[model samples]
Target chain A: MQALVIAAHGSHLNPDASDPTYAHADTVRETGAFDEVREAFWKEEPHFREVIRTLESDEVFVVPLFISEGYFTEQVIPRELRLEEWDPEKWDSDGTDASQATLEATDVGKTIHYCGPVGTHDAMTDVIVQRAESVTEDPNVGEGVGLAVVGHGTERNENSAKAVEYHTERIREQDRFDEVEALFMDEEPEVDDVTEFFESEDVVVVPLFIADGYHTQEDIPEDMGLTEDYRLGWNVPADVDGHRIWYAGAVGTEDLMADVILERAADAGADLGDAIERVRAATAAGTGDEPRSEPEPGAGAGD
Target chain B: MSESTSDLEALLAAADDGVAFDGLRLEHEGDGYALETPDIERTGLDEGALRDALETVPAYVSNWQYWQREIRGDGTARRAFLRRCERAPLADDESADHQPVADDVALSVPERYDALANGIDREWGQLCITVRFVDVENPDGERVYDLWHVDDAGNDLADLEVYDDPRDARALATEDEDGRYRPLKTAPTLRSGWAFTGLSGQELVDAVEFFYPATVANWHRELHGELDVDHWLETAERQTGIYDVIDELPREAVDWMAEACCVDSQCLRRREWQYEEGDDLEVDGGDGAFPCREPCSLVVAAARKWTVLESEEERTYELELTTSELNQLTDLIDAVAEGRTDEVREADVYDGANRYRARYLRAKRFDEDGNLEATERDGE
Candidate 1:
């Protein structure tokens, strides 16, 4: 049986930050594809590992519901869950796979499949492009203006910045933007390069992040040199220098994300194989020295 | 004690008789008691004599009001949920302005309603009220016009005034064209000292009804003076009909061919505000033009500057302060700080700004002990 676990990087400081995680949890649950589905958080309650203990599933699929895959997916989630990294068999004993044990260190036997964060997914660019289209009165494809995919890049992980870089190239492929550039807070191809790389008179930048936190609020404006109003729902015009740009609210504001997770759950059903064993043993023996052992690790497996 | 009553009567007789003891009378009963006039009615008692006279009465101590003021230097502190109510019975004496048993506020649909009604209707655009002249005359001093408009939540919207003739009443209801209804401009111009007045209560109410657009019907008036109740009610009803007819007039059409401007209430207000603002001498972006009549501009400017709404909301507001008020806030603060106003500290209210916009006002006196003493605010 295959089960699914959704992990979110929530904030302890804001009660509103957990709203999306809880919303998506309900979304995935409505599908009923996995024998069981649960959520874990970087912050707030039902912690990342304890969530796994409660599920007790042998086969579990972990999905990162974050904007970037760099530090959190590559180092942070692995450090917390105690599981092996993807393509572990390919790595030689150069201390590469040695750190992979943290990804899977539970009393119960379990096989986990971790998916990329949703922001790194192909479908997300459509949402981003759709968001850009909503703001401008007319999106001139012929104009050589650049679409800068700005994400909250952190020094903590190389993998996180790759997601933004990949998404930027995919966006450029659509040709609405003649030039597509990826910028980061932690890594290079930075935001300062934007004005230098700006090809046309007009520009529209979208901040690819989970929530409108510090990076989106203070840092982005500082990077862009906006002194006045929070540039929401309004665009900047050229001759105004940086005024030739506008912003879309963080992608988490999309109302359809709840539907996306529900769809992903339906596509990920692997049917529980371990729960069958527990049920058969209970019928055959009828009585045992021990009662049911803390819902076997793969109890949520097999829809 | 019974002889003391007789003695009191004898005191009046002795005063009339010019006998000695100075208006004092004595009775044979009750061991020869003496009587005097009530202390309130004293005419000839010297200050010292009055004190001495007051001392003679044992336990004649009368209590007057006193205050237990608790002032903590720090003082930082809709509706429409009614279910049901029975209809009120008709008033026994509707014409009586002073309802004897009712709360004094019963006389208030604003006590200034009379002054406002007959004074002038300076409000513009959305606030067009009607004015109709009624024969109903006020008994107070000048036999002023008894004008009323709408009924406010509690009292009638009446504006009474001592007019020389019908012309003064006519001057009040004249339309102001250069005020709030200027659709071409996003920013509203400032206005002041403009009142929208009507000749009669119902006429003003009808004008208000036309601008506000409500289906109102019943009309009443409470005139204070020697008019009979029958005439008061009849006049109140007549005021209603005439005012409603006046409300039926349409807004004046704008003429593009001619450069001439017709002054409507809104344009008039803006024009008036512009004249007043000219005196500030420092409104050239240093303080940003105060949108005296434009709330949206005021609210937005405050919002952009303040982290919390209250900080800006507390900005001292000086609506149409005369040259005198401007002096009082700035010059008086300077004078008081320099100990120039120490003799009596006559009470006044003035809003102060932090070199920026005035946020709020502090009026009324605080004694050296910080007790609020009664203040006489002498102003026009």
Candidate 2:
């Protein structure tokens, strides 16, 4: 059994940005589904290149801890890891091809399963709903509360905005809040236009970023007229206009995503049963008793 | 309540109502509440009692106002003000504790220097002092002292006044201007070069290291041939857009250049013909001449290397794979790195695989010929 590597874009300036990613990886490692679970970052150590060199396992599952399938996923990641050839134009023109969606192990000599970005998963809507519900003083009382899904939309790529829009629709379908609005840091509808989106007195903004980096920690708060030191989860309630704005942490850090990550691995043809059995056998051999079956799904999510 | 407390309360009430008690008056000047009681005898209280009462009244009033604001509106400003009050020494405590021990205390020159240094360190927050010895043979061996006012982070805030006489510097340290100490200027400068006549290189380095601990660490790193990348990067990141390469000079060198001659080729000082014409060769100093903006040789060399490093970029990838698949990928990469193509089986041509092959071949070719050009195409 090989390792499950979570790739994240860590920041040099902000420590809080990459903390959640490592915390989530630790949770998934505790599941005993893979031989090892590790975190590889772009900025911080252990750097992605350095991490690969240290890996003992040949078969690796890499789950991008990103919000969208854009330049990073299509060009940068493959180029760095020596993955198969990919045309950005083709992928951009008509989304991902079903045949090329999950890279087969036989094709690359060593099996490397490239899963869809964790943020783009269908299960993320549940996480988004939970994040929105967590910040509201009264989740049941939706009278004056609005949910705003904030994403890092780029003018360079329409897919970035589309991913945010997809999640917005999913969250809206749940009908948990009075109103749900999709907002972007770049391009329209901008995050600054948040006030005009709803007539509600309370706005619960759930940042759809993978990490709580500079954009989530600093830029978003500043743009929304909130004071600095506002953090992930329920922040110190900021007064924008006459309404109370509550900001939640990035969506990818949610506990539910642990299950999504496993699902992603399973979709990429990982044998979860075999990995679980190997762990259980190793534990039983060491302790002289059978270990608990797959110790709960969200074990390491919030840590 | 004590009799003194009751008397103080009554005095405060009279002061609040804008009423004059005896010959003294308590009035509100703008936002500040002040008691104008220059003559303590006119208030029918002893000098000590009057001073105590005055101190207690303002704190009580301020506390009352703080609470009033908290109850009526958001208490952000009130809370901050209260915090400031808590941190600041009370008026009575300052008066009692800060009183000088004696006007004339006979002390040796060394003792006086120690006392002055201690007083400046305690009163002016963070301060760095450098003393340069000059005219060692003269009866009164002259020395120039440079004092740098620094912030809590040890970042230089200002170049405090230089002094040739230790007595004059000590007097400035002990002087209490108005009720509070005089604040240092907001901007920093390297002024009045302290020239030493006979000090060796090691002695000068030791003197600098004593004042600035960061410089000591920098010196240690230099001995081991290590660059302080963080410090260099911090200076580089401050500038925006396209800037002259000279602007990227190391901060210490820039500071040195500002106080010395222009190293820039275009400068009149660098041109020998300007000196030949009996032109009083001008050195870089003062506002207009300081901070030579032209590309100097030192700056040009550093800028060339900096641009190369800054231009290169690295990317990271994230992939998902089954347990067995990850192991095989590892093997494939290892085989390629070691030039064992026979061990490296052909995988389906994908973006990652193709990229890996090119990198592997490049490395392999480089190892074989000691140059990547051996594998490069005609125009490439």
Candidate 2: segments with Cα more than 4 A from true spot: A86-109, A137-144, A228-235, A273-303, B1-305, B308-380
lDDT of 1: 0.40
Label model 2 with its docking quality class. incorrect
- Per-residue lDDT of model 2, residues A182-271, tens digit only: 999987788876888888878889898777667777788878877645454234567888888888767766655565566567767776
After TM-score superposition, what is the CA distance of residue A200 in candidate 2 from its true location, in Å?
2.6
Q: What is the DockQ of candidate 1?
A: 0.01
RMSD of each: 32.0, 28.9
- Which one is best on TM-score? 2
Worst 10 residues of 1 chain A by lDDT: A93-102
The digit string of per-residue lDDT tens for model 1 on B138-230 reads 211111122222232123334223332222222233222342121212112322233333233323332332222111110111111111121
